[model samples]
Target: MHTTHHCKARQSQRGISLKMVNYVLTHGALENDKIVLGKKEAMQRLADLEREKRLLMKIADKGGVVVVADGEALITTYNCSHRN
Candidate 1:
């Protein structure tokens, strides 16, 4: 049981790390091997992260795929039907 719990915790940490990497790669500016964001932009990004997280949680509760857009300051969600 202890080993199973540890494995689950490790998987959760990996997921979080992946999310951070994705966010950085999409939005962060890489300068001299360092990821950087401007003061105002950083604050705005934090707000956007919270908003996106809440949205993702709601969607996950309904068993929906998590969809995210580019890291621009604008937050937009599209509702379109897929045609098979």
Candidate 2:
């Protein structure tokens, strides 16, 4: 007998870049396809959760929103229990 694994896919669309999806998920913004967003919404969605606010971007271009950490762009990926 062979065992098959049941994998749960995250994003509704496969075209959504893994980096982009992971970005939103990690920041406590998006919840399973919903995002409580923030500013720069004109081209992207973001949220200042501490400030209790959200901004929605009207554009649909999948531009890479650079997130800087410790004076550098955080470009990375690793093997975790989850991924996009």
Candidate 3:
């Protein structure tokens, strides 16, 4: 029973991590040195992306223009070319 519970916990943790990864991948953008988000707008955008599985790119375009960060979210500009 204990072993089963432990395995289940691990599975759940993994799922959570994957979801976070997906969220970041679908939202985060790299500019210059740091990976950051648009702060206020990112929360809503993240929700929309998670529900629909489609990113709303009104802020930043994906591919050569913008690159996603690895872990944790931060605040930054929408334009990849722009620097702080």
Sorted on lDDT, best first, the list reads 1, 3, 2
Worst 10 residues of 1 by lDDT: 75-84
The pairs that clash in candidate 3 are none
Better of 1 and 2 by lDDT: 1
lDDT string, candidate 2, 1-84, tens digits: 232232114343356455654565565455676764444652343234423332223111323233345556566533233324
Local distance difference test, per candidate? 0.67, 0.41, 0.57
Candidate 2 lDDT for residue 14: 50
TM-score against truth, every candidate = 0.36, 0.23, 0.26
Per-residue lDDT tens digits for candidate 1, residues 1-84, read 133666467868777455554566678888997776667877998899999999988766665643456776545554333423
| Candidate 3 lDDT, 1-84, residue by residue in tens | 133666468868777454554555566787786445566668778687686654445344543145455567644434464644
Which 10-residue span in candidate 3 carries the lowest summed lDDT?
55-64
